[model samples]
Target chain A: MDNIEKLKLTCLHDLHVALGAKMSPFAGYDMPIEYAAGIIGEHNAVRNACGVFDVSHMGEIGITGEDAEFFVNRIFTNDVTNAPDGQCFYGMMLNDEGGVVDDLLVYKRGHNDYLFVVNASNITKDEQWILRQADGYRLCLEFMSEEMSELALQGPEAERVLEEVVGIPGADLAFYTFKEIDRDGDTVIVSRTGYTGEDGFEIYGSHPFIRQVWQALMESGRATPCGLGCRDTLRFEVGLPLYGNELADDITPLEAGLGIFVKLDKPDLVGGEPLRRHKSEGGPRRKLVGLEIQDRAIARHGCEVLSPDGEVIGKVTTGYRGISTDRSICMALIDARYAKTGTGLSVKVRKKTFPAVVVPKKFYKKSYKA
Target chain B: MIRYSKTHEYIRVEGQKGYIGISDYAQKQLGNVVYVDMPDMGDELEKGEDFGAIESVKAASDLIAPVSGEVVEVNVALTENPRLVNVDPMANWIIAVDIADMGDLDDLMNQEEYDIYCLSESH
Candidate 1:
């Protein structure tokens, strides 16, 4: 109800139905929101063991040309030039005012070649922006959202599961790093990265190769196919932001506590001075904070947050009762004064207010393989 | 006389007292009812006002009052087996109330009339 209908189904549509997933519309895709095994079961599965996801709906764009790193480094807020070949760096593209354009993963294929992993909804917009910027530079940028099918094998046992399928002991790929392995002795890229706040690899290959890879990985990992419903809660448990919820066009990275990724001191970069001003000016008016409700009342998105004495502060961005924690928790965008840990607060559930406490952010401590 | 509201609440009037529950349509639409909280005993409710709420895995929706009344008795069965409403919502009344306004009766629909109303929502 918080979003509109923008669903576009992928190759796993019938497979999801056959497995009894509850389908829902999300990010211009008709996706499996969850399996009938439920969000709790799916959520715990990804947290404890391993799980598979048909994330082919996410967008990917490629850049090639001389000085490609110069063009990419000029654009994203992340320090991508320092990222060696066969590795990825999480960063965001920003507007002139330093508001987030989109948060993405930048993969450096070589000195002058790069790949951008962007959110599904921003594919068209990001392509247009990248192409417009490419006009002056000697870079060739291409949107490749359709060329790859993304599958996530996430949990503690991710490496063990993938080693048998990838057959190369990809366990050597460090966190935020990737390697190309042999599929019939031909290379396919497997990156040890994830969005579910778990340890895993996101596999990318040709479309035909994905089906067999999916079956083999699922069989080897013994991971159940998790839907986006559990995916949202799983990520939220560890305080990883959703595209619309945490990273939006109007919200600046400084405001979202994402200033860590932006290197304002870098020489002659895009959006540098503006970011410097935000950094020096004591950050934004609102900051993100974690919350725990006293009651089982779920403080969902758009719910108003107030002080214990009823001073209105802000609103909830995302919320859920953790199946792993067995506690009702949420994250909110509140006045900087209330962002402190252990501040007493209240959330409006329907018509009544329930007491909650501002706890630490990243409620679930993720132990990914480093 | 038994009556129903367009929003899917059912009421059975016995003298000045009335019993309230949700219709089958409401329960079916809200799958796998996880929790229910009804109006407190002796609580006053205005016609069409929220008197209770039902939460499911998917989402949550409130139970509206069919007629103005003072809540007298509530079904404790909902606490343990809330899904009973989806199976036989009409027979499983959630609240018994003392009617606060008799004039509101004209706004309610009988079973056959309510079925026609439910039909309009069908695609």
Candidate 2:
């Protein structure tokens, strides 16, 4: 009864239902939120062992032509030039006013060929934005989201599972690298990248190929079938930002604590001048920080953040009980003066105010390979 | 006898005291129960009002009072193992209350009436 609008399904929808997954509407897709193992178990499975996710709802766009690399570096905040082939970079696309358009991954397949992976909810808007900015650039852009299906095999045992179960050769892939492999007269692109902080692999293939890999991994019983529910928790525990919650149309990477990915010294790019000015002057008016609540109440997204004197400052972007660390923590964007480490703050959870303390935004340490 | 409310809470009367908890349908919908915030003893609960919150893995829902009463006891067992609600909602009553008045029972629905209400709400 939650969703009245018609929902879209992925290639693994029937398989999720057959596995007794709890279905919910997320980013216009009827996706599985969790399976029979539940969120906590699946989350632990990824942290301790291996887990698989159907990330086909993500958007993929391909650009190829004479001026493809130039067009990409013109709009993206990162310096894509001089990077080695098969290297992937994380950066943001911003509007002229410095507000974020989307945070995406840029995969360099060759000198003039690149693959851009974006969030599912911002597909149409991102496509339109790219087209609008392609006035004088000579590049052929294609939205390949529908033709590509993605699966994230994440955990400590990911490499072993990929080799033993799926019969895929991917042990040599370093972090942030990918290669196209030939299998049975078809091509499958495997990347050593993941949303979770654990060492993992993301496999992109055709629908039938993805379905077969999912079945093979499930039958092997070495990889747990995870859902979108744990995906949020795992990413949040490592202090990664979700699009709508942390980086939105109104939030800039500088204000969201993602300035490292923004190369302000680049010759030119969208929102370059404004971001450069902000970087040179410490930061923007508001800054992001971590809050450890002294109480058990979970301060969820949009919860009002206030100073100790009860003055309204900012709001919480993401909050949860850290399943890995066993602490009640959250990320909030507050006035720069109140964002200092060890600054005392309070959050309004429902009808009561709870005391909280400012801390480093990284709640849990990342355990990535390389 | 037992009765249910439109908000999915059920109450079982024993003499002048009543036991209150959510129905099985609600627990199933809420998914895994992680924490349950309950009211303290000696707190006054008004009819058709929220007393505390029950948080599941997905979201939090308010626990509404089925009848006006004064809370006499709480389910201390749920504080340590809240998943007991998901295991057996009816057996794990959340709180015990002293009935303020007998007329409040008329406003609630019986078992058969509640079953029909759930069916209609689902469609």
Write candidate 1's Cα lDDT for B2-46 as tens digits: 999988888999999999988887776565565576778989999
Q: Considering every candidate listed, which one attains the maximal lDDT? A: 2
Q: In model 1 chain A, which range of ten residues has the least summed lDDT?
A: A1-10
- The lDDT of each candidate is 0.81, 0.90
What are the C-alpha RMSDs, in order, of all predicted structures?
A: 4.1, 2.1
lDDT of 1: 0.81
lDDT of 2 by residue, A3-110 (tens): 635787889989999999988888899998999889889999999999999999999999889999999998888888999888988999999878899999999999
Model 1 stretches astray by more than 4 angstroms: A1-7, A165-168, A182-187, A216-221, B1-38, B46-49, B66-68, B73-123
Q: Which lDDT tens digits does candidate 1 get at residues A58-166?
A: 8999898986888888888888776679879888888777777788998888888888999888888888878876777888777778877888888887788787664
Q: Which 10-residue window in model 2 chain A sums to the lowest lDDT?
A: A1-10
Q: Assign candidate 1 its CAPRI class.
A: incorrect
Tell me the DockQ of each model, to 2 decimals: 0.23, 0.47
Candidate 1 has a TM-score of 0.85
